[model samples]
Target: MSLRETVNSVDTNAKRQACMELINEDYNKLGQYKMGEVQSRNIMIIGRTRTGKSTIKLLLMDPRNVPDEMTLKSGTKDPQFQTFHIQQQEVVLNIIDTPGLFERSNVESDIRPDEAILKGIQLCANMEITKFHAICFCVALTSGINAQDVEAIEKLIAFLGDEIMNNSCLVITHCESKDEEQRNRLKLELEQDTFFKKINPFFKLGVYFSGSLNSDDYKHGNESLKNQYLTISDYRKKLLDLFIKIEKPFPISEMIISQIRQANDSVEQKTVQLEDEKQKNDELQSRIKELQEKYLKEKCLADDLRVKYEQQERLVTDSRVTHGQREGQLKNLQEKLQQKDNIIKRREKCQAQLGNDLKKIIEMEEHQTKKLEDNFYGRLRSVYDADKIRAVFLIPVRRIITDYLRYVITSFTVVK
Candidate 1:
């Protein structure tokens, strides 16, 4: 039988198997995922020493509560890194229940929870486990935002960077049988406090009434250490929203940079092509002009030769009535006229070919230039920058929410 099924059963081996299965399930569900693959969220529970960090983790992972078998408890009191998977919606959350921030009691001091908290932070930062999507900062609701709590949270924030805290949240636990009104009042009091206000803007806070989870005294009812398991679904929803906020900001900046580089490269290639087309156009125009000039010169020479031939023929006709010497001059003028006509005809053919070539060059250059303009302008407006920044910042906000909820509950109930 699975660990979850056997948790309430009498068999000890079944219980141990349940624990092992819970650990495995937790590991499988958490971390980045591919398409069609379910991705898991890593939620690190952090708080001061003696603040029910382990208790809360135990309750959350207990087979009586969470019906999962793959929950693995790893790490030490110095630097804990426990993994557990909780199926919520489309994704599974891999919760990393960390050690308390400081050593609160000599009894708990043997475990060295503070070091464990730091190590958990380091692990998340290094991407040793996927960066914690959300952090649970357990705080005492009665004490509100205390100096030690503040200091521990600040150290965590400093280590994780502003991004992680923005997504992390506070949890006010152990609300001593008081109803919602008392919890709300406590929340407001904390919010109004100077220290709370400073960190309030960055984190999301939540409240939970957790008396205890030790179910051994089943007949005693209220006297039983584990009586109620508060849902706090409202905060849970908000926490989910925080996740959306944290994850929404995709790396658009990197995408924009890459797009810009591609556009620049395209522009460079087009500019080179444009230059070549322009050069070719200039050459074609010059060639056409030269051909036209040659054709005009040949036509002028042909006209002069024709005129001279006509004048010589007239002289010969007059000379025929008087002298035979004009005949020879007429024949020479006729020969010159014929040669000039042939040269004019050849020049006209060359000019026609040059005109057609020039037209083609002009059309080709126009087509190329138009294409270059479209390509350059298309990339100019393709990129979006604001969306990318939002994606990066949103992840931090979700983490803040998780931290806030965990802090409130753990603080109120867990006694030092």
Candidate 2:
């Protein structure tokens, strides 16, 4: 196959996914003659309080510290650690022991197991620890039916999720139970529980009693509990068995002074990325708020302008109405002025006719008077010489008539 086609045929995520799956997969002994340096693995030992976990922890330490049974507390109170090398197996181990599930109270000092587990994981992530091979639970066979056990199991499951739960192992401590039937029944029930349902059966590290280092065995009577404990030889073998059955070790460093370290750089980087995106989202929200404010301001201004424009329009309409009325009034007034002009012209014509009538009357009156005067004068001149005395009296009368005629002529002239 061509190189590119060959690469495409194999899924890289699936290949890396293989890193997630291991059930009795061999953990090769690596040293000067093998792949690299002495390889190490991280293991978690979990269970309820006072389940002989301290005894187990002592046994697992490189130089075992014998825990005084009388001095040992009921609950571990905090997560503990150990570093040891199984020289025969050519492997190193870092085991973690937590105060068993549901042991925490409302007390401030005792944190919830799940929260402690998260804190522990975050610690590992901060230190750049990678890969948790197996999380081994150390349960007490004597008290396997505790109600709190279920919650503890659920918390552990939640802490790791189902994927990593598949790599888990449950080691039944206090294995020397007096009633074999009860132990068997309890084991069966535990196996059927959801905590064990998702896990690989082979990783169930066989029962071993985590007894006190300096105390009497009350279960088996006042003697020591050596038989209940795992000897160094058996411990090494079983631990190696768990390592082989669990997931692969991280490719980097080994023998941490503490707990299981998973590949969490992806999670951390994603957290930072999420924070950055959130910051940007907040900034964008602020900007949107600013824009909305600006838009509201502009809208208010536009509304005011619209109101003013409407007012101006109303004024213009009123002015137009008034102008129409004034125009009509002006037109009516012009019509009235034209009518008055016609009446004045009629009056002037009447005055002119009256003056012509007066002139005709005066001329007719003068004609009449002149005719009368001429007729009288003619009579006098015709009769004057015939009788002297009559004629002498007639002469004065004639003179008087002449004078009156002259005066009448002058008066007529003045009247004309």
Candidate 3:
């Protein structure tokens, strides 16, 4: 996830994951030896001038049972680096106590306090062994919320952005009130302010009411400072818990650098995406052209096929007309053939009738010839016994008989 997502949302797990990302990267750079080793973590202390950022830094290192080691010295003007350990955990802590945030000109140069702190945090990032774990914003409750305080915070937020802001906690310090009612009044004032709410939107991690670590000029045992200092034990423990909540420690400088590099990368990414889109659009246009040409060719083919179909239809119509005429002529020829068949049948009947008539005529002629032969035999026998008047007829008959007998005898002799 991006750094903006980690800080903009109210999800602790997201912020933890973001911290781990930088931590794992640092581990990679540290090499194989540090991979399994628990390395030291760092915390950045930031606040306006005289808000006791140095006191918080020292108290964290060692909850002071006594006053300042060197009484003459006041607040640190330059970035101070210190290392301390917690008894509960084995991890070491490197504190980067940034010089107070304000308008003070640098003693050696014209650099402002905010600019110096930026350089200091960058310096912390350069250290190979220590990574910034959490940030602590020191606030003096006795002053209540003021515009000057709000201005200082806005400057810090502008410098670091939300990544540093979200991982940070507001430390309410310098509460001199001894009575509960007085402390409640301070709390009520802080609660009503819009600026305090803006900073501590998530959780109020640490508040120092009893212990006050002031400049060397201010006596350590002053009742107000003493009361604030007495709260140091709880602050020390709770500050450790806040760092633990961060889960992994990474340099704030790394986050700033990463975000800057991402902007540069987006320019290049945009160019590549545009080129890819243009290539895809060109391919689509080419495909559409091919389909359009194919459609025109198919349309021409369809037109030709339609013309041929119309010609075939005309031919079929002509053939049907011709077939109808041929069928009519065939019917007339069939009628003539039927007439010739009737005439042939009548001729065959007449021929059969003529054959039967000829058969009857032949039978009648045979019967008449037999009857005439019988009559002639009877007449010749009767004339043979006739008297003298028939003598002449008998003489002729006898002569005829003699001649017939002679002819018969000669025929018989020729036959023998």
Candidate 4:
């Protein structure tokens, strides 16, 4: 066989040996109860971390191994098994002490609390030791059962099934320090606790207060210490007797195992889904950031364009104002030109009237000259009859005609 196969074989053998040990322990302890036949009474002890689960197991099954002082750290990291035999009655008690439920570990290699619990139950079930005579749910009395304890109890029930409580009982530890009145008050408080009341129906054997003293305290202590130790021992015996009195054992069926397997698969699927959703959210955020940057760039561009447009508008308005001033100057110049054209038209009209008046005066002067010439000609004819008289009249008439013609010529020139 190969090395891998050999290792696997060894592992299988070891597991079988462990199971056999559990079985043999039960058979040896309860042989007489079955009328000379071998039988085992299996009991499962469960509780939260540091609730004295392992300590309770040691004190009950092997008192000699009980520690002198309680350790602050957890004792059981995995499932453990022990068997106790009552010498007189020839009875066996097979006990499986499991790691605490809901235990937090800083170590990365440590198994999860729920996984550890399932592993412990599976281990016991593999031995065909499915039936449990008693399922002792341990709690520290000093802690006084809080919400975490209640949640742990609920988780245990979910794993093992509700019927496990049929043979289950509450085991309150650290009761040795409490006085009678204090113990009574604590019990009353437990009775009022919501979880306790809820599970009260299945707890036929009810709750048990378990306490233990170290060997040193028992042997060398004072009277009161010894009495307390004896009382604690008696409580342990009563717990054992309760296990013996159970008529039926709580069975761990295949259905419960199948349910646990399904639950594990569901948890894995949910983890994968959560990772996918987170990735999608990250991508969406990145896209949103990109869009916001683009929007800002566009807004800046728009603002620049608006400023340029306003500048251009101002330039156009100034041009329009200058054009209006030029138009007013042109209109004034046109009005002056129109006034000069009217004056020129009036001067031309006056010059034409003066020319007409000068032509009439010239015509009058010509008429007067003609009439005077006619009168002189007639006198010359009369004087011609007498030669001397005719000569004198000719001289005077010629002088007057000359003077008057010259005057008419000067007046016409001046008028032109």
Candidate 5:
């Protein structure tokens, strides 16, 4: 085989081995890894307050209705982490059901949302987990995303970086009733959201109604719980379907050629991006050279304008100084002329005033005028007798009260 063929063959064999190895880990590990064995994916179910993180965990770990003793003993039913091997695929899943973060009452000063997500990431990283494989951000189907949910999800995306999101899943839990319409609406909303829009392209995303597959009244064999069990089973199958897809080898190979094609496509995309960047850099260099030439021309023009402006300014300043001296001399002459004119006017004004004083004496005699209407009785009442005025005011009030009493008596007969 050619070297390229040999490498492709090796990759195919390695991928097959990885698939087998993952299946083995799921069966033999009993959900607990051997001291040094690695896992395929450690799924951390995270969300804001009461959004079914625990429900997702329970469904994943105990889909057969089997309880994990160690996790049960942990006594944190709401917040838990458990390792389990999924059937068939032998995918060893380390699942964490984190509690409602960003609650005012439940928030711990030390245990922040960042810490929770980072701890999950660290555990996966320590286990030498290359890919998250699947991170189901559990959101309640009944409610839309809140601020805290946004904050926690934002932090998680940042913590896991872009790779995790590419391989992530969105698990909507506690979906209301048999209404797929509501679930569909929620899914539409999530897709439209900016964060999910960015994440959706990378990850396999879908919406699920929890009670649809499992009736709320599920009884193991009992008819009451049977419906509920069926509903649960339905949801379980959905979960299985989701994780199975995630646990499958990245860039899956149901057929040999598809895997090769996906690989080729990835390479081609990278190559195109690289070529585009190179083109952008060359364009930027050309633009920069053009700008530099234009800048030099502008600088030369600016220098010439500055020299011309400075020479003109000097000429203006000289002219302004000479004009100012002439203006000052003219102002001095005008001031002397104005002073003489003022003295002459002052003498004329004084002579006119002496004549005006005598005319005022005659006008004052002619200007005397008066009105002569008389009110003879007005002077008598400035201080009237206080008793008289008081009686004048009290008379009408007394009459009104007397008339009111007479009217009330006439209007209503005595209690009969």
Candidate 6:
């Protein structure tokens, strides 16, 4: 080969070795990067403010070397990524440490800690980490359980889901000086808490205690400090083992986030629907009340009208009775008046007949008296002296006959 070809060949081999080393580094730091193989086990540490979430991450990264002041005071305001390499078992651990969920801030920002953490998880997809092998919920042993802790846990469960609880574990920090008995007592207290009781069944990985000594204590060569460090290391090691042994990983992807948003929207819609239904029910009840009042008023009016109608009917009946009595009385009065008129006509007719009979009797008496005088005078003249007979007999007989006639007439008139 020529000089130029040799130089090119050496450069090519150097580049090939460097690439192999890079690939090997990636394989050791993360698990086998090959598709379909179990890669690095991803873990997310979550907790409220100042609960030692960052401290736990540091200790897990280097359990033998105590964290310096810088690492201890490094409050994570954003998601921090770290990798742990276990060359002996060829296991890799990828950890994402998030900001405290309940950290107080004077400056209000649009992105909340929880929202930022979700964005960080989304960024992990670019690194080929689509799921979390485990979620560690860190709570300080010194900080007694409070409402804030409960609220943070509830928020996490709401955002992620109850499925996340299946791969979760509790980490009690600040337990460096606590004895086994004290730790057990704290655990029992946690179990007894109402909020913990509801979610205890979902913690499949169980609880753990993490305690760490400063670097200064480790450098003093004290046996007790060394033993304490070993115990802390063992606790962290067990946590890693648990992560590696997880059978399934909780998915963190855009699709999952979308699903969570949809669920929240559905709950809001149901709440609105319930409010609308309650309002409608109230309106219907009001309408019913109005209708009842109207019905009562109408009923009262109907009753009054019925009473008046009954009264009018009674009046008409009474009037009819009075009218019938009046008609009968008028009929009797007419019959009496008719009888009086008939009696008056009969009396007038009888008076007229009596006057005619009296006139006829007077005429008959005058004619009879004249005839007797004429016959007596003729007889006296033939039998005796005319002058003497006329003077004596004529006078006496005339007087007697007149008297008799008067008596007869008076008696007959009285008898008739």
Could you report the Cα RMSD, in angstroms, for every candidate shown? 54.9, 22.3, 32.0, 17.4, 34.0, 18.6
Output the worst ten-in-a-row residue range by lDDT, candidate 5.
Answer: 368-377
TM-score, predicted candidate 2 vs. hidden true structure: 0.42
Q: Mind giving the per-residue lDDT tens digits that candidate 6 earns over 310-371?
A: 99999999999999998898888888888877876665565456546755765575566557
* Per-prediction TM-score to the true structure, in the order listed: 0.40, 0.42, 0.43, 0.51, 0.41, 0.49
Error of 2 at 12 (Å): 46
Error of 4 at 118 (Å): 1.0
lDDT, each prediction: 0.57, 0.59, 0.61, 0.73, 0.59, 0.74
Candidate with the larger TM-score of 2 and 3: 3
Error of 5 at 32 (Å): 19
The C-alpha stretches of model 4 lying farther than 4 A from their native spots are: 1-35, 62-65, 107-113, 178-182, 214-223, 258-416
Q: Residues 108-195, candidate 4, lDDT per residue (tens digit)?
A: 3444556766767766866667678888888887676776666666777777778777788888887755666777797798779887
| TM-score order of candidates, top first | 4, 6, 3, 2, 5, 1
lDDT by residue for model 1 over 1-416, one digit each (tens)? 88876775767877889998998788778845634555556667777655555555555555134212212332225545555544544565556666655554456443343345545644454444545566777775544567777777666555445665445677665443445677678777776888877677557433343333334333344553332433333333445555444552212133433444455567679999999998999999999999999999999999999999999999888878665555667777888888888876766665556555645654564465446545544554366443453356534544575466556435533421
| By lDDT: ranked, best first | 6, 4, 3, 2, 5, 1
| Candidate 5 wrong stretches, greater than 4 Å | 1-39, 64-80, 105-111, 126-130, 179-182, 189-204, 209-225, 247-416
Error of 5 at 41 (Å): 3.6
Return the clash pairs for model 6, or none. Answer: none
**For every model in order, what is the number of clashing pairs?**
58, 5, 9, 3, 11, 0
Better model by TM-score: candidate 1 vs candidate 6? 6
Off by over 4 Å in 6: 1-38, 68-74, 108-113, 215-223, 257-416
Residue by residue across 1-416, what tens digits does model 3's lDDT show? 78888677757778889999999898788757442344466777776666666767666666664445433333767777888765466666788887666635536433354565565655564564335566676776545556655666666667666555555666766542345676667667677778777655522344434343554425544555555455556656767766756665544566664553464367468878888887888888888888888988988988888888888888788778777777777777787777766665665565455445544543454355445434544576577543443455545654574566557546644543
